[model samples]
Target: MINVDNLSYSFPQKDLYNKVSFTLEEGQHAAFIGASGNGKSTLIDIIMDPERYMFDGKLEIDPNCKIGYVSQFSQLDKTKEITVFEYIAEEFIKLQNEIANICTQMETSSDIETLLEKYQEALDAFDAIDGDDFESNINKKLNLANLNKHKDRMISELSGGEFKLIQVIKEMLNNPDLMIMDEPDVFLDFENLNSLKNLINSHKKTMLVITHNRYLLNHCFNKIIHLENMEIQEFDGRYIDYNFSLLQTKIELQELAIADDEEIARNEIRIEKLRERATYNAEASNGRALKARVKIQERLEARRIKAPFVDIKQPNINLANNNEIEETIALKVEDFSVAFDEVLLENVNFEIKSTDKVALIGINGVGKTTLLREIFKNNNDCIKINNDIEVAYLSQMQDEILNESNTILQEFYDAGFETYREIRRYLSNYGFGEDRIEQKIESLSGGEKNILQLAKVSASKANMLLLDEPTSHLDTYSQIALEKAIQNYNGAILMISHDYHFIVNCMDYVLMIEDKTIRKVSMKKFRKMIYAKHFDKDYLEIEQKKKSVETQIALALMDTDFERAKILSQELEALIKSL
Candidate 1:
């Protein structure tokens, strides 16, 4: 449905795309993935409105095609006081209002030509969205997303994740020829994220999504459009398959690179000997041999192997803890109840021991963020923190911790850095280049802002961390690095996250909020819950067996029992095949 050929675009700061070509056919769901600040959103904007850009490219879009876009930063005005249905139907309402206004004007004004043209345009737009059935379509979308009960609720009453899903419903109901969503799954809770995955899988039209969400990436897309180093590649397969192929290719390339390095080393030694001999002998043949050796060395250097799509820069995320609290409880909450218009959580109790890595999880708008903030403040009667434990907090909203107007250098300065050179050296570990250090925080991408937050948190040297949705805008590479950091941290962590992969990777246990109280769940039960909800019932059992067999194999190998290890290995392979 969309074809981009030899598209070359650049920003004032750097080149983004160079001769990039890709195609999205009808019914193809494509994931537009890349590192942060790589112009994924900018490309989407260009595709939506190519006339606004002056670039060398051929962008062919169907003439009759309609597009529905959900921007990453699009937000509803909470104070607008409109119902969810009214908000979703805003476009239909506008077209109807415009048609009515034009008809009224045409009846009195002498400018009949202008009024008629306006009326025709409004009518066309209205019909394009099937204005007659707009309400029904909205209801259908809400039902599909399992949000029909919230149709009459005020838009301001919705949580961030709820509102994000509402935006998806609105766009899906518009029945566009293609839907383009930018990071629509960024901060969604687990349930809402599942709803979104279902919506994507069930949609019968074309889609182009830009997200770093591994869950959605693995389950939703049939095509992958990867942008790296100003080049784009299209893969026509599942993300899991694509990842395996990339891994295989990377291994092959690394082997070739090692061989190339060895050959170059040997050639260098040979060239050194040839030159040494040529320096002593005045023979023409000796000089020619040295020249030939030098030429061969140059060719080897020029032909050195380099791995493709495997060198993307990853941030060095370090969450430091110097004071390791061993025996004391890091934090405690008892009989905590928070209320706004109504009681959200009541009589909640939880505690984190020193060096414990725990996840605080609940549905969106279940007061998870509020609870974390209260713990951070530590002024309430229901909260108690150990005197020896120093705390650092990472808020989900970047504005809460970062000054948008300040440059990276200035921000680090405010964070207690003594010198600009020191700040530059520190930020470099988080993938901030020298040229980007002077740029204001507002200009950085969402992922970059999160990286900056992590950097600041790391510098705090606190023994306890209260993190709220810490992985919200981090790209996949940064997310993985953050996972490793969390795993290696000696400090206690009470993190609120909806990322299943991250939670399983880094957290030792879960503190789940249910029915206005806290319930501690083991990782095994958490895995069971996830598997039952998102996968087959047998999946968890099979995974457990696989883990057991692998452990057995490892023990057998350590004991020098080769026969036992081979038997356990075969059993592990069988379990994996079942999965």
Candidate 2:
């Protein structure tokens, strides 16, 4: 129930929205997607608080609408020591306590008028959200998200993904008319990501989500609002169908562009001949012909195809090792146990050989990050590392490796860059512009920070890497590029990740945490385990087949094998329709 018309906004460094317009109607689940640093979050801010900005636009929000917003980077104050139930009911509890205090004051106060007015205000506010049933509502939401067991737990005890879902449940209980989430799926584990998908699917009210998560985009939204090239394209369909249509359009446009290129080449030759005749003959007729030919060439050039949406730039991530290590144990853990208040993992043992790429995976809050950090420190008696192997570590928390107070240039300098020019040149491959090189690292977006981590890690040239959730905040294009880099890295890797697609694409084997112990499994076994837990066994099988067919179709089309391409396209269509 919001409409934005003719909106144009920009910052001092770059332009964002240029006469962009879109609408969010009731019962619509819209995915707001775009490249990183393209003003998706800024637009959300403008919608939430328009008075803070001075821009030329007509934003018409329904006067009676209630909005709920979840920011991209939100953290709980663990020092407060509040339970999940109490945290979700904090607003209602405040209003209830205020009403009781006002009533107690009315018992013996001379300023009865003031007390009565304040009491009425508190009562009305409490009743607006049905405070009488707030506890029941909170319980129901927790049950719906399958988080009933965590209702009585302390907020500090929950994992990042669990806390995020708790925030969503808290917002839902507010009975908002519209809910907006900015990258709610950024760092969630697979199970938690699926929980979010189910929550979005079951939501009755309108929602607008800004995320680069392909899983959520495929499974949750009915509408797609894509911002590209400083404009908007709204599609009233599933993202899968939209992507298919985009692929077909790109192929057709490429064919037309090929023909146009050929025609332009011939036109250029004709113009050259006419110019030569005009110079030799020195006649008015020849000169006029040359002028006409030149105009035609200009017209053809102007009409050449330009596919802005089809051609998106990706970061260059090359994690190539500078030196090779002998075939030896890169890392080994023996009889290790980690605990804070209670044991989470016990008697765990694992080893990685030089040049091996292995994934250390488990559900959220299962000590994966903890164990990885301990290995990086190499101080524990139970852990062993080879002396010849150089190590690089990438933490999911950017602040652990990046200095927030330092500029990008300074950070790179600390990362061992020799000069400012060299730092700028290296950072450009990761999509950082020269204008942002002098800016503080704290000012960059989450996605930008993650890309900077990749750049820094690649520069280390270490023979061994310990990466934790390396793809958390990256966009889809950057994710693909990182996957390629990981696949080609000439080093040993022990990565902690919950991104199924990324893990399957990059790692060679799995070292999974199960029942408080570490166990290694083959890639084939890991695939089966995932499919059995998360989907039908045939789900990934069919998807792989469809991808193979799509590739074949593209190659056939490129080779001008129209009949073969048509056959493959039909097969692919059938597979998609079955899905």
Candidate 3:
């Protein structure tokens, strides 16, 4: 838990926030949403005390906490090039060193060897709790996000989406009591996004998430903190509730602004008159009159001009100009297969249309991304469409589009924007301001870079948006905002995300890609399939057996009898449940 009181932080512009007071409780999930450059990141940094930003008031963190922060990206030294296993194992080594120091302090005899063994066990136990399910957890999450099949590969070799997976995997392993995740969903596909949201739901710790992803805010967060008008305010609702309410508030603010100006004028005239009267009788003013004069001065100074709230809306992209029916296809595939030494999947087929707003859906490692790429490649004649469809790709891992040497604005410019004004306008839509546009893209977090990449694509004037897991790092509000933007987009959208809410909200059709195959289903039908899949007879039967047997085996593990351990182990061979 942490508390800030009467907090005011400043930059060269207006106060990022002023006189703000709030508390983040131990078990609450706080989501921060704002138009770009309203100081969401600055607030987070201030909370974390990263930049040593000046504070006007107080920030108090719980004394009994080791806060685990998952930054938007992994910024390891490139020279290391570690594997996932190695990366996680190193944490245990650190734990080992800590235990050694503790044992050294508690030393009593030459039996220190025994202490070493005990400390080793303790450290091992520490890692095992998180590492036990880590293999399956990472693989399941990666496959869902389309980042599997590369787990054994060096971290440096991972694509943008893949690195995002690494970042998530590392964070999940920490098991922090207080998790500060920035754009935790940036690189996940729909199933992985769903898995991520569920994982966040299961966590029993406090979370402060900064994202623009609407789907996350809608379901995962219990509180919404909107940054507007140089102050922070909390809304008790989901992302959708807060956003629409915010939109209405923006309208109301404009009316308030009009009324505020008139009030200010009247107050100024009153103060002038009061000052004139006080000036005439300065030497003989009594207590009541002096008090009245002081009160008038305070009232005149208190009426600060707060800017009316403005919605950080999306760009109005126009691509629908077709007057004739071009019953052609955009992508064709036949016997499109991909495999490792072991076959993940093979022999896929699908077609895309310029008019379709489709979602790529599948469980992790079902080859969803592979299928999308295959569809884009040429295979056979059954698929018919215009070959000239310009695709705007927003990869789940923004590293693909992000260049360290390039500033955020430079990346857009490099994407072939003709002018500076165009670049600024595009960045603004993604919540970036003029100050942020010039910041290095690589310096930006995974989520910030992602927004920039999306802005680049939108500014590129592309008609077919080939989005591969764009919801990974976005906060819940941003997710829905994007969903709304996509819904309004006339261009064809081929998006791959694992957020169920996202897929359900923005997509009109579904593309189920698994085992190197592709099948197009209606959104309604896909939902039905998901429901039936969960409540099937086979699953229900196994689930019922698990509940009854798990308790008995756990009890056996607690017993000292050799026969009981053997018998219980035989009766329930699997200790960990699949679900």
Candidate 4:
């Protein structure tokens, strides 16, 4: 169990948390959610180590409880030349070494009895910690991820997605009592994401997850802790439930504030009338009536309630609507192939209509981003676009487009606004006040950069938009607003995103890149097809058989039975060939 009381933190610019408190019971899973720059990640850091952040709070953790943490941007050290299996079984190897050392001491010690006792103790510790099952656990996780073939591969050679999966597998091997995962869904494909979900659900340990994936939050977490306006609100349900309840609470508070304001206004009017009468009779009266009226006003002031919380206004994204198109095809690709160190995509063919809204989706390391960049390059005849059509591309690294040295006002001006007043008015439409307009771009948070990019794109006169992972850093409300804006856009849109909710709501057609080919399908049909593939009997059977062989091989290797491992390897090869 973990408990926090009256936690507060401050930075140079703003206070992140103020008098926040919450408790997580043992074995409970919860999610922390809020807008970007509202300190969700900072709160996690404080909980992990309050003293490190110098936060003012009271935190309590159960003694001797182990924690496993997976950060959003964790990367493998390229200098460390270690195999995937060795990395995952590191703790078990340490325990084995300790036991071996104790046994070697027992061989020639003068105090044989004490040495024997120590050896036995070491063995018991190993068993108590489930060290014997480490190999099996590692193999099981790898096989579930269809990564058992790479068990002996160097960690430094793995792709970003593979490295992330290895880290998650290592954490699972630790069998920690508490697990904290931040943005674990970033590089995962749909199949791997489901694998991760199953892995998380199978473990009963307490978990705290921070993710922008609505599917994960709604399916995995039972409780929510929302951080807003330097305050925290706890809800005893999933994301959908919490959202509904929050909306209801906001409505009630708004009504109450309106009623209180009307009452205060009426009391003020009465007070003014009483003072006027007193002033008219000043010559004949002693001013007792005026004093009484002043006292009544004071009483009324004491009864005034605090106002309701109003959310910061989201930026108004207004995409240009261009209905005129001389050509029917906005974009077309034929026999498109791209290769770097290895072949990523091959023989892909697709086309986009003038007013089509299409989504490009594929597994991690399958070249979704590469394809977008290739299209933008337009180096060959394989890709074609309409003549004289303007295209606006928003890369995954969209934040890098901003000039750090320039102020927001200057940036807007650089985007082609003529006068300061015009730029100011445009910025205001995106929720930027005078103070924010003067702030430098370097000081802006990730979410703020995203909003600025959106504003720029929306203000562009381009007839075709290419967006790559555009919603990754946006808040929930901003994402919804963007979806609406995209829906209202009259031009063609071709976007690459892993956000399922955003894709389903914004796109009508799907362009799935797999097996070196591009297949065009409806979004609904694509979802059903993926679901069917996940539950196919033959696929499940093959996966189970491979998992069994992999587990056996791992156990044999752990026990130093090389002959047995060789035989199991043959069996694995045969199974693969049969599949």
User: What is candidate 3's lDDT per residue for 1-579, written digit by digit as tens?
Assistant: 888888888765345787887788888888877655466777778777634776788888866666667666655455667875556445655666777676775576577677778777877666654644655655665565445566676665444444555665566566666778776665555445665676677667788888765556657998888777678888876664564454344444554565677776776677666667777766555445656766765775576546444433343333333332344565555555677545655666666676678898776556666655644453535433466666667765567656778877677767887788988876676677787677766555455565666666666666677788775655434555577678877667788876665687788889887555678899878777765753344443443354335334334333423355455444444422332
Candidate 2 lDDT score at position 270: 95
| Residue pairs in collision within model 2 | none
lDDT order of candidates, best first?
2, 1, 4, 3
**Predictions ranked by TM-score, top down?**
2, 1, 4, 3
lDDT of 4 by residue, 1-579 (tens): 889899888876567899899888778888888777677777787777766878787888887777889886576687778898998888889879988887788777789888778778878767755788878878888888778988998876675567777888788678778888877776676777776777677667798887766666656888898888888888877775665455445545555666778877887787777678877777445377667767876876787665545544366787774545764888899988988656877888899988899999887667887888777777778999888567777765644567878988888898898998988888787767665788787766556677888777776778888888778667765776788889988888999886665687789899998897789989879767765865444544554566456556545544545567567766766665664
> Can you write out model 1's per-residue Cα lDDT over 433-467, one digit (the tens) per residue?
88789888987778888899999999999999999
RMSD of each: 5.6, 3.6, 14.9, 14.7
How does each model score on TM-score? 0.84, 0.88, 0.65, 0.76
Superposition TM-score, candidate 3 onto the true structure: 0.65
**Counting only residues 3 or more apart in sequence or on different chains, how many pairs clash (N, Cα, C under 3 Å) in candidate 2?**
0
Model 2 lDDT at residue 390:
86
Q: Provide the global lDDT of candidate 2 against the true structure.
A: 0.85
Model 4 alpha-carbon drift over 4 Å, by segment: 52-66, 75-84, 90-129, 142-165, 280-305, 310-312, 321-325, 339-342, 385-387, 397-428, 431-446, 459-461, 530-579
Q: What does the lDDT come to for candidate 3? A: 0.63
**lDDT value, candidate 1, whole model:** 0.84
